[model samples]
Target: MLKKLSGLSGIAIIAILSLQTNAFAQNIVIPVETQHNALVLQTNKSNNLNIVYVGPTLTDKKEYEEVAAQYRQTDEYTGVSNAAYATTGSRSLFEPALTVTHADGNNSLDLQYVRHEAKKIDDNVSLLTVDLKDPIYNFEVRLFYKTYFKEDVTEQWSEIKHAEKGSVVLQKFASAGLYLKADNFWLRQYHGDWAKEMQPEESKLTHGIKTLDSKLGTRADLFQPPVFMVSLNKPATEDEGTVLYGSLEWSGNFRIDLELDNQDNLRVIAGINNHASPYTLQPGEVFTTPAFLSVLSFHGKGEASRKLQSWARNYKLLDGKGSRLTLLNNWEATYFDFNETKLKALLKDTKALGVDLFLLDDGWFANKYPRNNDGAGLGDWQENKAKLPNGIASLVSEAQANDVKFGIWVEPEMVNPKSELYEKHPDWVVKQPNRQEYYFRNQLVLDLSNPQVQEFVYNTVDNLFTKNPRLAYIKWDCNAVIYNAYSSHLKNQSHFYIQYVQGLYSVLQKLRKKYPTVPMMLCSGGGGRVDYAALQYFTEFWPSDNTDPLERIFMQWEYSYFYPAVSSSNHVTDWGKQPIKYRTDVAMMGKLGFDIVVSKLDAKDLQFCQEAIKTYNNIKPIIWQGNQYRLQDPAGNAVAAVLYLNEEKTSGVIFNYLVNNRYAAGSERPIRLKGLDPQKRYQLKELNLYPGTISSINSNKTYTGEFLMTVGYNPDVKAGRASVVLALNVIMENS
Candidate 1:
């Protein structure tokens, strides 16, 4: 009943069935259009669709179909490796594409493929639907792949519709099952902890299954960031090499599995966490999974990353208003000890340091219980009258009088057991009916799954904004992940994870609509919720609580691959013994901010800080909105460098950091920059006034972009720790 398609290679055509010359050939060739390239799926002799080519442009060449039908055949029929609706009892033993639990408790989905259809939903979007049905149970599923031609990304998810006389439960369903060649394929993932997030890890793909998942009910947990990439075993440099990457646009528990089959075919399965998740569907009911965005790049990992970054900035993330503001957060300056006078003094120093926004983080709320510590007053949103008798309005007024914007911090999704809100709505927290609640960080997560609870959270934030009309920004922090995951109102307890995220999304959407102008940031104690889904709601993300520039070089390098610089809020913290210029240089690469005590620095250090802030403000437009390139791998080398170039290639900046490592041999290496118009000549110079503290280049000179990229710029890094910032301007265009 099935033909075996064989002879598939890296860009090789698979032949399953011999087709006679006919007009129907056009129907067999499926072409998906995207912003950067086209993905062509051609049906072979097996009557199944397989990817033939994914490249720069769409082609209707007849030879593509002919070659697809001309490949060698096999005797055994194990079904196609790239099964659109791979089900139970199939030849494949990896994760099933669809698992349907019948009313009789039998778990099997025997689907027979019917046909495939395509539709142009919009000028910039195309939709492909593959139809499959179970012959015995009358269950049907439409696997969908939507492509945004301008975003250079494809999204996949499935919609299941049941016509069975009885009910069925959808146990496991993957948003996409991408099949790729297994020859020398490598998997790259980002792993780290609370302070050190987005650390890149790479390994070669071997036999068996390798999975990356987040089950802590948070998307970007301490162990894993919500992204996976695969490239050739020998990856090319930043500008060249073929790579493929995918990410789930969900903030809740999710899983991504990569399995290499016996025939050396790699299958990537990604969707919601199905470990304990099961959705029951009654007769005439339907279920749909969240989309999994997948991108392919023939050029290199950098190109693939740029595609995702462009899509995120242009469509997903909040639109920017020119350059970002240099903010000064008071958390590090005075932790819970500041009053009106102290804060006023800090504001004057912040204004003197060229800070445009003043953010007052945690410990400013609560009247019944002091929020001086994390153990009390989390759910309380009122300003502490004892700490600030003049109230938050006066603080906002003070900031405005100093010509700086004002912002406040809040953790609306969590509650302390000692708070008034928790005492009144004890049942609102996430906990089982009979089990004792286990608190994380002395705080219990509010059950946003409940609609009434969501309304309360919304009102709390809305009232805060209503009370303080001058509040221009909000630091929305979620310090703890959901544990003891149980919702009292939901009977299907397994759906708690899914419903909790939905409720959180509802609250965020409501707040975004109510306060369109005020930008809110996403922070999960630091970098836990920094995913594409969260970016749609928040304007920027705090990369980490650890502001050590040495650690940040690797963190920002991996983080910027999928996200633009504007999405990251980097702060210069006063880590003991670290130089101020080194910290300032690291933070200036992204959305620069100061998390140190501005009033405590000496006159010399303060002058350096003032000059650094001015330099960042002058070049922030290129840093925030430009194409970034990791010039050197910070993890592998002691000398790390990163370059940012604007769209026009007229201006750019490069930051070089030399770490103090015993493994470092004190060898000087040429740092080649990328993302430049090779025909143009550029002039590079160090931005700082401090002599010999930070070296810009081996030779202070001008060179063509081609020579800079090919010949390279070597920075004079001493044996000790040091950092330098280079400002580049276009001098001439050879073209």
Candidate 2:
């Protein structure tokens, strides 16, 4: 049953295997809006390691009801995950208790986790220990996790992590691999009880950022950077990699291999023109790749990633050049009536979108202007002047005489009790200056550790970037949700969980170190501050303002498992209530922008948004640089695509999508392409059902291939929506 509890051990290892595996096992069924559900885990692997989880008895950490409290009920009331309710314990929520220790002898493995402390939130008792070691074995199952935050409630700690965070390439095992390290820099990064402040002579200066194979040359594909520890001497709490500051800074590492003799449960990868190929795995064979994630730190190990390379010469993305400028967003064309000639006709449609950013969100400096629904006059940043009687530096010099680049929108960490900055700093907000003040969206938060409200939200973005030098993209919105959880900059409530995540990482590292390269994009109310450590200094990530293409295929397949489609933007909306070539082919696999009214799109949806913006800028140099393959199709789930070839195979782009309505009568479904050019031959084009009939495809496995070929994306036989395109021809062979 998990392979007869994988190769036994024990007192015969828990007396003849936990009384013959859960007393002749049986009952283990699942269903109910589940995303992932792996856990048959019961490992103990030879040379006597250790094991014990037992199960249930959570006792309220806030009525965290159950995960496995008496469970043998298949959907007996949508069984678990009411968002796994738990203010305290009973975290089965996707079980885990794996153990793998190897040793030919000379033993030591007394590992005893034993968690049964029902509501242990503050009376504190959730001990997690890892002593893993192995030339042979002391502990090394090495990979298996689940928990994307369960509860911190001001660090009362009911934690769980891993529902997405990446570095891919795990299990091929031609040798040994994998080297995770999380003692948050060996022992503490703003969390507490580093084994009770290990005074073994304290130390600190750990900065990090260097692996992909020594700053760019690559080699890592075994299980992954799994030692994610953060204890900055205990405080800042929020899991899924929350780099709290002041100490401990353990770098990152996730290397892979050691496919413990591959009993292959599946691992077929290569698709979209290595033709008809898509599916992946090898770690109980899972499958999923393409990772750039916001990894705040990870400089080495996995044997310093075989001396890495490729940081892409000074990692820059869009250039108007640092502190650049081109802003104008009135929520996709005035959601609130603006007075100044409909706000100078959207700054004359923002000087014809050529650039010079002009932003003006949330009906301007409140006081019942957009006719107040909330936030009455929000810390008064002035100039409503009857909704702009030519003020705000005359609409910032009428958007610098239409050259464009003006900004405005401030929740200034909120306050709105009908306004006047909470009738004058209602104790500057996050109360305990005596009871009651916690409101969610109607608004309240402020106390930015109070340095006079972080110098009034930094003198209101430095007096609008000191009277606008074309003030750029700062769509830094946060609409609100972290309720009344007080924090007058900490003294209690368990030291306000490291000053509420060090006061939102100190106003986002001082608004990105005083606007370094002003191309910000971390909008909250939209994909709620899309994660991956707010992409180390936010460059771009809106992912969801809900541009709906069948709700962006599970929101861009759950943010393309660890984001990076040129930091993902995807807008192109003008009301395609359903199917506009399947929402511009799911916004041409990212970095594809547009928000309606190019004269309300019609000439065949404006020639399919100009051939989906010239097949997304002719595969914008391989969807902004390639090697992204995300497919898992073994004649199942009919199809879903995300290919991005380009490790010098000249170029690539396979974006495919087609949810199995099954097509066998005249079957034609080949798609096995990934990082192609087994010797040049591609040129395929379908860029949104255009002038069809093009195919060249070639590739015969550099790691996988059969090189498929079958095009007929249903569009009543073409020129309306079905698509495909493959292009290679770059083989400068020199080996």
Candidate 3:
């Protein structure tokens, strides 16, 4: 008979037993450590791995052993242990990491410890793989933990394989599972609709499960992004307490489950949502889930964001070190109503304003169907001969003549019933056999699960680049979400969602390989498909369609929590009553661009626009490649400020916006800066100031960094939608 293990004696016996069995180690400890964080796992006497501790880095092996011993006590009633990779039908009563039906129709899965391996990939990266297997079946699971030492981030995913002769059904498979123990858990999640994306909201986790999910098959970010932040012991602040932040690197249906178990343990399970997706594993088949990136920060959410931004720039994003060009997109300006002559006029204005690129958005395609509106000509990729008798090459040459690079938009993954391509290949759209098809923006989602459809999408991009060698950029847009998601190409209907996303990734990977240097922007009806997986192929993304400066102040602030400013494309548009200078100020915070017709601006506004673009170009390096500090959050404060300091801390820029008139509530308070060299002397100058407005700071005065950071500097922004941008440079006594 087996006796229950407890205390130090139990740990000692388990350690001795581990020496006997090499494959099934009963008491082996595995440490996945970054520079500042550590996640330690150990096997219990029951041959199950459990997360012992996740906090500050533990230096020695003895510390890991001690933590494991401390957690060895079993519950009096349930006797359930907190398995690191919890599975169904084992002793786990909480939400399991995985659930599956075996070949014998048994849904029970009892995973036991098999082995683990650690490998140092590079000077700054390491890999850890833990292997687990069912004691009764041939099913196997391998958990991968990749650590970026300097970034303080660890990416986790899982691979499932089976050797059974018959097929096994996968009901649910999570990308990662994190178990935490704290007195109180506070969660921060993002929620919004089409125009208002990435709005932050915080709430306390009580007794049950709190799920943040997205079921929109393609537009997963339309409701909630697969990201979250959890603070232990108290509400999360910018720079106060311990915070755990993570994001799922997937662009499909995703779900994040935060469960507060009866034992007061918090379990976080995140991955692709299994709503209508149940994959089957044939004999000798293996399946891999998407990666979930996470980091543990004792320095609060501010440091967490910085670490994630650093990791993305250094490793994840495409051309992460490169800067984005300022382009003028014609969507809001021309709106599919321009010809070659009109486009050339816009290009002339773009060059005069010092913008780097000109983007032609939509309505450049279709001959028979004529893309005059969203109801027609989506799948048709041919040039609209009626709109421009000279074709796209003429516009490309015109843009080149103006010394500006050119880009065009394409919605390759969508189709309209009125288009020639759709009329010829109606079977290519995602639809059920007997059900009516649903339309979004008068378009249907292309069935990318079909190899023929995937080939067409890939060629749509390849042919354009092959024809126009001088084409500098591609704005890849997807305007519709998957509605009748049944795919005729899929063998099993349940495999549609997963296969479609895989097919999309395959197309993007091929395009990236072919056009390695060309830049691409991922826009899915505005902020719909902004995930790390899609961002791996694209250089930047359109944060929102609503270019209202007031709305963008809050939207961009929340977005900065996870993504860097370089990956966001903000455009000054004619959508609101805000001043052109105010609109330009908000747009300059990210990759600067213009969506309004330059010719329509008055002389005063146009001159200010030119100067603002010049200022943005001059300081683009500091804004793009800098550490961001949220001096004042726009959630409740009347004055919202953001500071971007370069890595050297010698130069920086500050953007302050008076969100609303608070009747002198926050006017007198000065904005205290961060990430500055306290001992160094610095000089400040105001950039892009309104003509009639007075300067808030004494631009002629030189101040010490210590005084600037401690006493702070007030921009004295006025009530009705005022803004300011200040440039900072270290002062050299020798100069």
Candidate 4:
């Protein structure tokens, strides 16, 4: 019923035509297209689908034939090895794409392709659905492939529907699977912990099973980063080799397995981790898995990342396109010692530093529950009248008068045992009945899976917005993990592990619908819930609580590969912990902000703050909306650098850092610039003009982009924890 499958031989065409009209042999082929590439798929007689081509666009039948022939030469299989929607018998040897248990007491499954349909949702979007039937169990699996027109990425997900005749148990189901031709491909993944998140690691794929999975019931950074990449041979640079990448779109427990066979066939599967507990589905009940997105790039790791970033900019992030407000948060300045007078003084200092926003973090709410620190007052959202007698109205008005917006922090997903809310509804916390509950930071996670609890959370937060009409922002914080995990509402305890994340999404969706314009930031004790799923609801993410610049250089580098700079809430903080200028330089690579005791700054430090803000504002456009290039990798390196180029490639900013290495002579490596017009002449200016900061460059001068990128520019040596910020602007176009 859709446009003809495009390309096939005489026998293949006859086979396809015969199946299209017959109910028993109906098959479909789906073609997904991006701006520069096309992914063509074909369904065989058994309804099994194969990835025909993931590289260049197939315009004609001849090109498609050649691609298919080339594919068959490598991966010689009737099916795709692990086809979509279709299921293979146990004797097939490879992992079953969809394993199901029948009501007849047998767990083996063999699915036959039935019917399919195609829908063109938009000019840049298309949807393909293929139906496969498990003849023995009378069940169906609907495979979906959603492709974006602008991004070279396709999202794959599926739904399992059963008939009313029998009950079935789904043993294992993959959201997406692909078999690729392998030749010494290098597999890359990210691993880390709380303050240290997204540590990139790689290894060569051998002839065996290699898997990266998380069974902690939470998508913690310590387990995995929810994304993986595979490149050819050695580590691919920003602009050279072929790279294939994939990312899971769920925030809960997930798994990604890369299984390579003896024939050099690499089969990759990614979806929600089953945790060895199979889901039982009754007649007419359906189960759906989270979406898994795949992308192929021929230009290298840098270009592959840029494609993902393009997708994030168009679909994931909020509608804002300008530079984020430079905020000065009052956490380190005055934690828990909340008073009207001290906050007012800090507000005055914030205004003097040209900060665009003021965030009154923590200790602003829960007076009746006595929330002073991590020990109390989490779930209670009532304002603390004792702390601020006049309420937040005065503070909001003061910030407005100073040309700043006001925001507050709230941890709605957690509750302190000492709070009134927790006392009123003791069963609201997540815990197994009659068992001792575990507490982290003196708090327990709220059982969001309960419908009544979801409503209570929505209304309480909705009421806060209804009262405070001028509240511009909210810092949504999740301080602890879900321990003693059990929900009383569900009879099956295992469902709590999945439904909890879904319930959280429901609450966030309702809030986003109610307050669409107000931007909210996502933070999980800092860097715990940094994934694509959470990014869909929040504008920015707090990657870590650690403000150490040396450590953040590595964290920020890992975060930038899949996310834009504007989505990172980086800050300048704690000069005593690190050099003030160096911290400012590190924060400038992201959505720049400040977190410090402003009143403690001397005249010289105050001047440095003002100068730093001025310079950042001048180059904020490129830093916010630009292509990033990692000049030097930050793998225990003494020197690391990152550069940002505007869309037109005319102007950019470069941040070069000198890590904890004092031996400056050997560390002076020439830095090569990227993502610039080679024919354009550019003027470079050094931006480290603070009191204690000094530049390594010999001079501030002009050079062609070609000379800068190829010939390279050297940094001045002699440093003990230092940094350099350079602003480049196009001076002349090529004649």
Candidate 5:
């Protein structure tokens, strides 16, 4: 019998029950659904679980059952097409999600359906766990699925347990495996290096395996973030096709494999990369993989991104719904050469610009091995008496006097060879027993895998907050990559990569619990540590070190496809020769900040910056909590535009940037806006317009949202005047 619980806002809550069978073959079906999406799993007569469907919600249970029945395999070759968690050495031949060598020397695994359970965590979320066991060995695997009803997102992970007397070698353990059947598949991936991060690359899937992975154990996201999107039957677009997207919640070495089988089914397996790191599970021991979050959208990549952003803000990120403070960092301003007097002057400038927070970046620490440059004083956390005679408390007091908050930067996970900390604990760093040590930025990675190192890292933050209780923010940086990859504390060095991430997470979790409200920014040379697992503890992330405005336009555009703009710290720096207004306009797309020396700004530039800050404060709500639409792609056109529409579709903002004018002959075409209420009228106004710049559209005109969305307005941009930001508000009528 099918029973229904009381629903919430038209969302049906179906009771989980197994259908009875009179014959020998038993059939089971489990439907995990949110408001907008559904993931249905079914078991065939052989007791093998398979994913029957994963797409928009199928409200009719009978319809989905019929769909599942139609997919019953009659041939052995196609049996693995819809496998829920394919394993090695079964009848399957695909890339297995779980691979283990048993203690008795058997390498093959055949998992059978044992039982399952489903429960609601709250009104907005539900969890489902399916238990599977090997018919021969004493090995078991439990797959978990957590669905967010309102956000239309599903999170999946796996737990493996062994009951054998000896130990089992686990080679591959994927968090989640998804199977989709489509006529054609197009994969969109984000990849880049150092300052050039989050660059999007799209490719069509053929009959082979496509792998995206990271071997940089510590700064995993330096080359690529553990996230991707796949469009069905067509090239990916912002708002027009069926798209599936997912992201891994691990900050260590991870891998994503997209394999297109001969049966025209695309299988996606994602989890921690087991490259040269095979874990051993003892008797009664359980190993759990990190969560893999995913969403399926019928309306296209735009809808998928909006759902993910909503989930991240409402559930995953720390204080994600709150607005970020507009900060000014001193890295580009003074570099590593500032004292109490210079810093207090910078605080006055910060107050003059109306910035909320002032960050004292590097160079404020160490006495014997001062951080005068990037080559020293990384792990040492004590304030340099020579640089600031009164310590960090004096700066905090000065910032309070100027009505601005104080923040400081620290690279706690790195140690310079010239520092006292490394000399004190030589074995605390990650290095092979006798091999040569490789250095990056003249520093080595601290072994977070060791408990002593974890304690030291935690105390570094505790001491800062204890000494200066009014410290408003912290910029935690990791400048060194894992080069030696060896941990002396562990009996098996193969566990170094996984244990190091766990150790880092342990330290962050403690800090988050201690200082529940302090905002922290995660930076790893640049966007290297921008994964969800780390974001849970930090408030925002520095997207890149290169603060060039033109480069940021394209970089932030690609970043917005997955992450929310509110958590991205974009700064206006002196890296490029672009105009002050142009630089400010680009940085305004995300959490606004300034990295240049404000004291050196000319009179006109200073006035423009202060006014621009005021304007950003007025429209930040729309940028932070709204649906983003890529009106134009920078890769395909000379001019790129982006629009943000509030939840109610009442007010919005649009920013357009001119990349180059050499091939911009037809760049004056009016771009059709998106996500607007057709019945209302909007008044448009230009903001932060450069002096003497010609307006592309009539800024004083009022147009119906229907007309604005269909016909649109031209963004006439030229080389001299490179960018424009327009604000739109509802034109209220006399009701």
Candidate 6:
């Protein structure tokens, strides 16, 4: 097989120089080459199988470049338990290497392990099994990876054979093990920005992607389909004797930031997964294992994050005894430059409306008055004594005197180049040293990977919380997307990803430890970091800053799949200005809050706010703790619906929206309710408060099998006017 493949390609720079057979009729071959241009293998010569490397390499290394590792002495961090589940024990730890061998048998395939390195710290060497193996490869050759780990990640997790083509380079980032993927390189080529320069990548129209007016795409450009993945998994538990895989390769390089994404955290849990590799291990043949890990994890970044997830999972927010947050939002009152007197006036009027929370939004601390720009005032997490007179403390006192809780918004992840902190510690920001600094929203990301930065942030948050434990709520904001894939705290540009995420986690963790009881609100501008991972600690997720209700109606609907409605804090937006894009009702389904200044609320909007709050108060419990089912996809359909139930199974609420061009007239849509008693018949109540009413439909019926229930539908009105409201309750025996 080696001879046949070697003869076919005259530029066979690398071929297994030797073959060894041990216990079985197996053949093991280790090929040596400066760079891997292409990997082609004939498994059996008879066209039975062929292995090829057509993608990027380990370093994402470009051609004619040296992808070298400054190999450090193998040392363990500390104890055996510190080995995260991946490490077996210290005794077997050895040098970085690869093992390739084939178990010679009539029906045997080849197995390959590249760049295996394991060791123990403090005099212990742990034996490691490089987990890189693509047991089944009926699919095409493709390498897909994502940086998904939360804290701890290692190089072994994402090591795959590097790929190279001509002068351009491509690298594998399977740091996180295996994606549920089944696509081809040809498929990826058509849509990929990386491969367009060559061969039309995989052929399209005669004219390929023109770079004449070359412009790079946004972060989402990296997520095209046709991704190649090795479906890898592990034993269900520790005792299952699972081994981690290792791989190596060399290829193309480019600049990219993976960003502070938390979606993949749950996948890289350093434990067993249900989708382990599902094929036998053969020797000698090069097999690619793709994964994502904290491969570029920075260690010197002493900063760490604590989440309210497991620790405060059981905590429930308490209502204030004196009054609810009659909040005065600087955004609605005056977007950027509101002074103490302006806020004071707004507070006085809001107090009359029963607002208890006096929360300030952006533009309070910078000299620009309102956010004249992003970079100027953000790095300074201090009071703009100029506008905030007497600082936030005085306002806290003032609010306290008025019997209102004081809360402030802080976007800790950002640093404005024009702010004091940025000026003081210019090295603190992540840039290419001399390269053009990439700015997003006029901000630069701080290198939280450093302990000094961590302490600085800790001190800032601590001073505020400790000085005033009375701070009831905090809106933690992240206003910018990161760019310039470089980190001063890290050894190189590759390490930026792991370090930035570590920094975010560190700050959040410290905040949780200090203010365990405070209801921390998560707002990534809004909806950016709004996911289950953030919710594990954050009590509320501000859906977005754009409060156009027409937009919120569709937006909040899409937000429901992964998030509970009560945690989605959406305020009523201008129904008159942007009615098509503003939706007060769907937005109110979340933890209902106000965004506009109460002093500006007209008679009708104020009444609507009151009515919305009341409705929220009634259905709040069900939305908070109820089991949720996505009846309609707000993203796809004209509208969406949710069914909520109390634990007792005695009562439940069914809120449905006929959000569509109901003009095709009205048609009944079937909804199958879950978690109901089969034996009991429940009486239905339609909330008359809603504009439309369900004249009649399936009422009290025993749910025997998977019962089907149909809802009486109404025809279309305008775009967002149609709604269906009903409440289902299981009738009690005596009642």
Q: Give the alpha carbon lDDT tens digit for every residue of 1-735 in model 6.
A: 555565333333232221121113222221111121211121222111212222223344233122112213234332111111111112212111122122222221222222233334222112233322222211112222211122112222322232222111112122222111112111102132221211112211121111111111111112121111111132211112111211121111111111111111111121111111112322222233322222110111111001111111222222211112324456765777578888877666556555457677777775543344454888676677767768777777877778777888877667887787777888887666778877877887777777777777777767778777777778877655556655666554543444454455577677777676676677765554533334545777666666755456555544442245556676654533543113445554656566666667666656555555555567667666555544554445655555666657667666665455555523244555655666665765544243232344445543331342333222222234355455677766786
TM-score of 2: 0.31
Error of 6 at 362 (Å): 0.3
Candidate 4's residue-wise lDDT over 516-614, tens digit each? 767778787777777777788888889888778888898898888778888899988883366787888899888888998877888888898898898
For candidate 5, list the clashing residue pairs, or say none: none
Tens-place lDDT digits, model 2, residues 388-438: 765677777787788766766666666667777677667777755556665
How far in Å is the alpha carbon of 73 misplaced in model 1? Answer: 8.9
- Please, what are the lDDT tens digits per residue for candidate 5 over residues 1-735? 222323211211111112123113556788889998878898876678899887778768757776755653435464555789989887888898889898887899877787899999999999999998775566889999999999899999999997866999999989999988778899999888888988888989998799989888897888888988999999758888999988899989999999988767799999999987899889898899999999888887888888988898899888889978999999888888899999999999999998999999989998899989988888888999999999999999999999999998988998998999989998998988798978998999999999999999999999999999999999999977888789988998878899999999999999988998899999999888888889999889888987888888888887777789888999989878788988999999989999988889888899889989999999999998888988988888888899988999998999988887585444578888898999999888888865555566686688898998999877666676588889988988862
Better of 3 and 4 by lDDT: 3
Output the better candidate (4/5) by lDDT. 5
Q: Each candidate: how many clashes?
A: 4, 67, 0, 1, 0, 79
lDDT of each: 0.77, 0.40, 0.86, 0.76, 0.86, 0.43
For TM-score, candidate 4 versus 5, the one ahead is 5
Q: State residue 114's C-alpha deviation in candidate 2, in Å.
A: 4.4
Q: Write candidate 1's Cα lDDT for 1-735 as tens digits.
A: 132223233221211122222213544766666766666666544444455555556355555555434434333255556665567754545667678788767776655445688899878778899776654455778878898786678988888888665888878877777766535678898888889788777888888989888887744566787698888545645767778888988887888888877756677888888877787788887777778888888777787877777777776787643345679999988888778888888788779989889989989989898898889999988888888898989988999999998888998989998899888888898877687878778988888889999998899889878888988888899888777888888888877888888888899889888886678788998898877777788889998888888888778888888888888999989863568878888888888889888778888788888888888888888888777777887777878888888889989988888765565543377788887778888888878555335443533467888998898877665555467778888886463
lDDT of 6 at 415: 85
TM agreement with the true structure for every prediction: 0.90, 0.31, 0.95, 0.91, 0.95, 0.57
The C-alpha local distance difference test score for the whole of candidate 4 amounts to: 0.76
Q: Which pairs clash in model 1?
A: 16-45, 17-45, 35-149, 241-300
> CA shift at 41, candidate 6, in angstroms?
27
